[model samples]
Target: MVENRARGNTANAARPGSDAGVLVVGLGRFGASLAATLDELGRDVLAVERDPDLIQTWSGRLPLVEADATNADALVQLGAKDFPIAVVGVGTSLEASVLITANLVDLGTPLIWAKAISAEHGRILQRIGAHHVVYPEHDAGARVAHLVSGRMLDFIELEDGFTIVKMRPPQETHGFTVGESHIRKKYGVTVIGVKPPGQPFEYATESTRIDAEDTLILSGDTVLLEKFARRP
Candidate 1:
């Protein structure tokens, strides 16, 4: 929401200029949507695009650099160092993504969110100091697989030994508030949230009751959750 433009350096007053306004590398569908979303939310968005056409298209709406995001020198000349938070959204070109992520890390970006093509790519990004790495497609596919496999409702991987999962409530769970379920002792999983049919889900309170059709967001080991998900 940087309404006041002070010279070439416009400080996002809300987040501050020093806060590392979001820097998005790459200009594809995902990149465009992300940039547009930020702009809509009054966030100052600076982007780097390797493709000339893409850069030209978004330059008017956003601060775009029509150069390879992989080049440190090129980015330094174009104001990349000013931002601390960056995302490498180059999905099609794996080479560019790797080099650009590496270059950003070298630039000392405090928070780097990189998209990985596979687990191997994720490992590479992690090794290079990427704050977090994700394979959106792979993760989504895992959820879909679970649905088809008829196990859990939703599965989210957190740190090791901890996971956030939604389980299909059985008849026993019906008419029981979260506190009454004794979830922690019974399932060895902590019920952190709940999702009931035809209703929006939110963090589960002690009073949150479990309906037969409700899905629970539980946190614990994946193995036990899987076992619970399969049990009748």
Candidate 2:
């Protein structure tokens, strides 16, 4: 948490404007990373932090403002109302997070993304006008568990309980045609595509052959996908 202090540039001087500009509130891990990455992508970024020390430290690398983001007046003075998107990066402090988010909402910020500490926090953030609520810790934990299980080569979580996984075709399914394998019937997963070790990707179809060395792209319910992953 940034202590209340004014140190870095806080002037509302003429600022640059582009469709790529991003407003990041809070100089914590998520906010800092997002700001840096966006800057690397050639986008203009305005990062805010209450801590004078943090503002001083990071200002050399990017545009930063030292202010209490929970203060609506401060946000307005910082010219946050014009930002196309604002990300509230303080997830641990529910009060600070909510206040900052609400301030952005009231400022008519078009898109607000908030980090949430829990399910309840996520719900509240969404209800309070957060366009997107991210649970980084929970999602990272799920990814780690999948990696440790060694069933999937990669995983991408989609909306709700669905997921996309890349894995070698199970031994039992090798040499069988996609339709013959009956994966959807047995595992409740769909094989969207496949690729050989050194070959280009090909769409999976009823006649596509499933080889042991073929990497399959499957998508379905998270539970069912994990079940399939454990098979081979």
Candidate 3:
């Protein structure tokens, strides 16, 4: 059984206007990074790890529960059921990730995010009730492919056939007002914002001009996005 190291009763941990915080299972790179980022963002975070030594290493930094996250009772004992969000981050262990996700689901956690080793693993996670499935390896590979292709500065796939992309404005479109570019009419994409070199992002408007090095943030259907990307 893991010791309950939460500052107070799990049911009462969240104040009236505050959230119940997040529960991170596993202590690997993904879990650690999520926990650290949540803590940095001023969220309450409780981390779980099978290895006591790892918890000791992270002592004084994050609240922790030393136990096997794959065990449903272990998680229940840690008061994980009350957390608003639960993340299963045992990237290399599909079984562990699935088990933790199942436990969180049974606990009625509002949101569950699980890391998957492959598409099949992701499907299993979703079937077992993980609200979000992340494929870090696949996503990284896609990002690298985009960068190597020299068309995309950044990429986010919102769904199967829609994407949000950041890329340099087409050379021919330079010196034209945003409305004059006819991007929506010509390419079927929406320019949401512009990023000039060394400056903050500026939301696009009718009068915004496209400069030589300005990057554009756009959203559109996948086919249209690919067509737009292939442009020089």
Candidate 4:
């Protein structure tokens, strides 16, 4: 049985091909978080979940329906085809995840983001037409590892091995202009910005001096970024 508990203005619902709204399938941790964030951002979101308990828990908080996303008929009933973007956050059961993703693909959801537990799972999702595959656990673990291993304040890994990090300026860079320190030439990393204590962040330039007390925002290949952050 499909139970819709969506609240809000139906007139404001996004039309097909519009980027104004998103359909999230599954109310697992990832899906719930994503939906909440989107809602906070003021985007129209409709969440579909199979579990009645999960639906009840999120009721009045999110516009959602109680329906198994693996069933294409249920999705059709929910106007899934009209949604420009969809996220498949069912990662617990690989079969269910695949089925839900496949159903979304068949419904012509223009953009599909799916969660995968492993490389094999990710590959399958991509092969089946998931526009984006996220490995939340793997990514969180890597981010935490980077933070604990060095003096890094934060780390963000982007596609193609590129990475960005926030860390204190190395002792070698103290009191020297960016060009004089030769950080990019020596460490193969570019200091993109700097944030001093109680001061607004500013873009880094060749003439911008690095202070040991200031935080540096650097970008480079993952390996080089890690090596540079390890500097004492």
Candidate 5:
């Protein structure tokens, strides 16, 4: 049985490929969190979940349907193809994840974001037309590894080893302007911005002085950035 709680509000109100709304499949931890965040951002989201209990749990919180996304018919009935963006958060089971992603592709969903438990699973999702494949657990673990070092305040790995990090200015950088330090020439990392203690963040310039109490935002190859952060 398929149950749609968005009958009146979203049934025909949103146009296909419109940015006004999104279609989210599954109600697991990731799915639920995505839906809630989208809601908080003021975006209309239609969440689809197979379990009746999960549906009931999120009933008043979000507009959702009780249907198995692995079934293409259920997605069609829920108007999945009408949304410009669709997210498949069924990563617990590889088979189910693949089926849901494939179904979204068959429905011609414009953009698909699917979660994968492993690299192989992500590759399969990509081959099946998922626009973005995310490995949440792997990414979280990697992010934690960087933060645990105590030197890196935050880290964001973009692609192909390129990364951005927020950290304290190393001792060598303190008490000197960016031009005098020649950090990029010596360490291959560019200090993009700096936030002095109790002051607003400002873009880094050759004249910008680095103080010991300031936090620096730098971008470079991950390996080089780590080496620079380790400076005594």
Candidate 6:
């Protein structure tokens, strides 16, 4: 398992706290990104996947467990119940996803987040007691459609139901400091990050300026988000 000790900041994770260790079963893009981001924000990670090569690649990067998360006993062996939160991220494989969700419920894995392929799969996850169920592909497609329409760049929903969105800076808010533009005041969206021209996004800074080409990643209510994104 990988553990980080960064000073000052408390951890931010999709899983709950109290037990620092996090078990990410399934090392697909989403699982891998989730593990990395959690570690980047300083949480201990214990990652698992059925692919031997993928496990080998990530071995020791975190406590990489080479096992099929779909197996009930395997997850227990990997100490999944030791953590407060667990993520079941098997993609496309409906049986595997269902089995893993069932396993977590059977083992009483406190908070389980599962990825599903359909509405039916979502129902099964709910039946098995998944704390959260995500249709990542659908969600991503929605954001991409908006982006393709030149209306948004990216969108992430933090656990609290607050939407975090990156979009082509709106006309009124372009070319202003975060506070000067008053995104919070006018749109009620918090300017969590801003990308300036020819520069990478300032991910967690408020003082960053909003340039014409800049994309703003904001956090706020969904209604307000839709309002900001819709064409005038």
Between prediction 1 and prediction 6, the one with superior TM-score is 1
Whichever of 2 and 4 has more lDDT, that candidate is: 4
Question: In model 5, which residue pairs have backbone atoms overlapping below 3 Å?
Answer: none
Per-residue lDDT tens digits for candidate 5, residues 126-229, read 77877778888898888988877758999999877899999998898889999999999999999999999999999999999999999999999999998888
Cα lDDT for residue 154, candidate 6: 76
Pairs that clash in candidate 6:
1-63
lDDT, candidate 1, 7-56, per-residue tens? 23223223335434788888787777777777777777787887888877
Q: Model 6, range 117-171, lDDT digits (tens) per residue?
A: 7877787777667777788887887667645654667766654557777777777
Per-residue error for 123 in candidate 2, Å, reads 3.3
Model 4 lDDT per residue over 2-94, tens place: 111122322334334443679998888999999999898888899999898999999999999999889899999988887788988999999
The TM-score, computed over Cα atoms with residue i paired to residue i, of candidate 3 is 0.82
- Cα lDDT of candidate 4 equals 0.86
**Candidate achieving the largest TM-score:** 4
Q: How many backbone collisions does model 5 have? A: 0
lDDT of 3: 0.81
Per-model tally of clashing residue pairs: 1, 0, 0, 0, 0, 1
| Candidate that beats the other on lDDT, 2 or 3, i.e. the better one | 2
Q: How large an RMSD does model 2 have?
A: 8.2
Please provide TM-scores, in order, for all candidate models, with all chains considered together.
0.71, 0.80, 0.82, 0.89, 0.88, 0.66
List the RMSD of every prediction in angstroms: 8.0, 8.2, 7.3, 7.7, 7.6, 7.7
Question: Deviation in angstroms for 19 in model 3?
Answer: 2.9
* Alpha-carbon deviation at 54 in model 2, angstroms: 3.2
Each model's lDDT comes to 0.74, 0.83, 0.81, 0.86, 0.86, 0.74
- Report the alpha-carbon TM-score of model 5 versus the true structure: 0.88
The superposed Cα distance between candidate 6 and the true structure at residue 112, in angstroms, equals 0.3
